[model samples]
Every structure is written in structure tokens, then in C-alpha cells.
Target: MLTRDEVFAVLQTVPDPEVPVISVVELGVVRDVDITPDGVTVTMTPTYSGCPAMREMEADVKAALLARGVRNVTVRMTLSPAWTTDWIGEEAREKLRRYGIAPPGRADQGGFVTLTRARPAVACPFCGSTDTVLQSEFGSTACKAIHSCRACGSPFDEFKAL
Candidate 1:
């Protein structure tokens, strides 16, 4: 009979192996959490089709729950609607910023950008500059892109538009 908040709290500790700053919940990988009479079922979607970290993330979640004395944890992967950055919470975005990665855009921003739309403006994390350019559509991982800040001459990874 655990509350949703309690479940989220336990899940907060399950970090993405690639991005330590954001948890699976923050990355919007987890779509649903259901506590059944037998166990807990966590339904998740991969950020991308070929996400390599998804396996590790799933394991982390189950292990975390087991550690918390909750056995029979089940991690279910779903892909019908796909995972999106819009699902990320505000607090998680702040954590990403603090971790040096540019947070995803909000409403009226690139958070919902499709391929046909123009790219969104990315501010520099080092000097708060808007004159940034995309170094590569793909960054160290499939979920992010490399960006360079013109104002401060600093390069950083920006969470790619979902």
C-alpha cells in the first residue's frame, strides 16, 4: 500500500548509467508504475530504438526495489507512444543544469520540436550565452547532441530535441 510519492522517491535513486545527473524518471523512460498484489510493475520506454543503456536502467530499478525490501519487482518495456522529454519534471531539469547538460526546452520551445521545425536556441552553461552552434546532432550518447558556445568558447552537451 505504498503511495505514488513513495514509489517515486525510491525511483529517484535509479540513475541513468549514461547521465548520472538524471534518473530514469527524469529521462521520461518510465511511463507507468503499478503496485499489484504480487509485485510492482514498472512500464518504461526506451529513449531511442537502439538505446544501449535501457537494459542497465531496468536492472537498476529492479535492484533498487529489491534493496528496499520489495521483491517481485517487474520492469516492463513499452514502445507504443515512445518516451519524450516533455515527461521530465522541473526538478529533474534543474538537476541536469547543475550537472552541466542543457535541459530540454519547455512549452513553446524545442521540447516538442519535430524534424521539420527549426532548431531551438541553446544557452551556454558556462557563460549564459545564446550564441551556440550544434557541433553534432549526436553527442556522446544517442539522447544528446554536442554544442559549442560562441560567447564563452565552451563546448557542452545539449539534450537533443525529442
Candidate 2:
């Protein structure tokens, strides 16, 4: 039987289907891991409700553990407390920038209240410029917003802070 840490190590190898550059661990979706006599149990919080990639992620998690010789894995999806961009690590932020996607800005004390008004300027991932414009409220993903950098004349996706 594998330990919780060992199972986590295996899970860290499972990458997100939409963002192949980062793993589910780096994405901050894996909430808890438990190793018991029956098998391993993984608790996950989706980035958002009705996220299309969630089922694929569940399968990937199961496949990853099974490939390591641990069978009977259970993946539980939790919604309480919700998921916020604040959960993303610093390393993951830099990786997102390098991958041509602007990471989410810091969440304010009032949470998403700012979203009701004008959105804060999103820095360009290509040129690191704050002079960017929102091209569309929707991006490739529902969780992201599309923006164009005036300085670099490049279009990029900003991971909306939630």
C-alpha cells in the first residue's frame, strides 16, 4: 500500500487537460488525499461548477494512481468553501505567464465585488505591460477573459480572479 504522500507524488504527475503546462496539484484542485486499507481517496474542488474538464480530470487522477499499482481509487468532488484564484501558487503563476496566459490578480478583501464595475488592467504576458484592453469578457475558457496588449500588440487570456 502507498502512503498519502506517495499518492500525492503520483497525482502531481497528472496534468490538466486544458492547461498541459501545469498539473492538477499545481492548479490547486486536489484538496485532500487519504490512503486506507481499501484504497486511496482523493478530495478535489473544481475550479468552477460545470467545468467541462472535470470528468477528464477525475479519470486522469484514477489512471495515474492505478498505473502506480494502487487500485480502488475514489475521487470526491467538493463544493464547500469554493475555489479561488488565491489558491494558485507563485510557481504556478509564473508558469502561466510563461505559457502565454496571464495569471489572475490578487483577490481583494471584498472578493469579486470589483468585477461588478470596470475590471482592473491586466498586464500583458508577452511584454509585461499594464496597458491592455479587454477584447472579450469570455476567453477560451469560461474562467478566463480575453485581452489584448497595446504595447506588444498581442492577444492573451487572463485567468479571471474568483
Candidate 3:
């Protein structure tokens, strides 16, 4: 019985386990939300197949929906194609930067391809400098790990590889 806007309002609060600043929508994880007569069925795609945070993310989504008085919730995981940071909208990108994790940077292509977080030139989210490198492939959480910005001489956790 809930409207799509109502659903998205609730979902906005469901933060990404790895990147707190960005919600599942910003990360392009929660692909669809269905308000059916039977119940609510949420379709989602993981950033990657091997993403360890998948279970937690699904649980969080269900819990969040339920908290909004939605019943018969179903969180379905799908990997039809894949996830890309480009799906993360500009507003979400700003939030990511403010969260202190660098946003997507230079790639081999002329930005024609999806913005790739993997092996990207992530600038220092804090200093806004491009001199940054991956400190660790894994981060504090199962979904993200350590990174160091050479320009600002600070270390940060980038979104973990999906």
C-alpha cells in the first residue's frame, strides 16, 4: 500500500555497510523495489559476485523496510550484468567524497565506460588531491579496505571490490 516515494524515503536511510555515506541506491546495489499485493519484493544486485557484505546488506534492507511497516518483505539478489560506480549519481558521488573516501577517477577510456572503482585513481576524499593509492585491497569492513593518499599523506578506506 505504500507509494514508491515512501519506499525510497525509507531506503535512503539504509546505508551501505562498507561506505556509510552512500546508500545502496547510490552504489547501484538496490536495483528495484516492487510494492505488490502480496508484499514488498526488493530486487538488488551486488557490486560484485564475491562481495562479502551481500548478506548483511540484504538483511539491512529487509529490516529497514519492515521498520516502515512493510510486511512480507523479500530481498532478492541478482547478478544479471554487474554493478558500476557510474550508477552512483552525482549527488551520491558528492556524498562519497564528503565521507572521506575518494570518488572514481581516471580510467583507460575517455570516461565512455562505467566509472570503475576497482584500480581507479581515487583522489584524497579529504584533501581533494589525486595523489592516492590503495593501501590495502581490503578495508576495515568486509566490503572496503585501506587506502593512502600520497598528496595529503593520509590513509583512508576505499569501497571494497565487489
TM-score for each of the candidates: 0.88, 0.95, 0.79
Better of 1 and 3 by lDDT: 1
Query: Compared with the true structure, what per-residue lDDT tens digits does model 2 show for residues 3-30?
Result: 8888889988999888888899988899
- In terms of lDDT, the best-performing candidate is 2
What is the overall TM-score of model 3 with all chains considered together?
A: 0.79
Error of 2 at 38 (Å): 0.8
Residue 69 miss distance in model 2 (angstroms): 0.6
CA-lDDT, candidates in order: 0.82, 0.89, 0.75
Model 2 misplaced regions, further than 4 Å: 113-115
Evaluation by lDDT, superior candidate among 2 and 3? 2
Q: Write one digit per residue (lDDT tens) for candidate 3, span 1-162.
A: 678888877888889887777788777888888898877988999877888888989999889988888878999888985676557777887887787865554223433333344465666779977687777665676545577888878898665333
> How do the residues 43-130 of candidate 1 rate in per-residue lDDT, one tens digit apiece?
9999887899989999999998888877689998989686777788888887877788888775344345454567778987677788
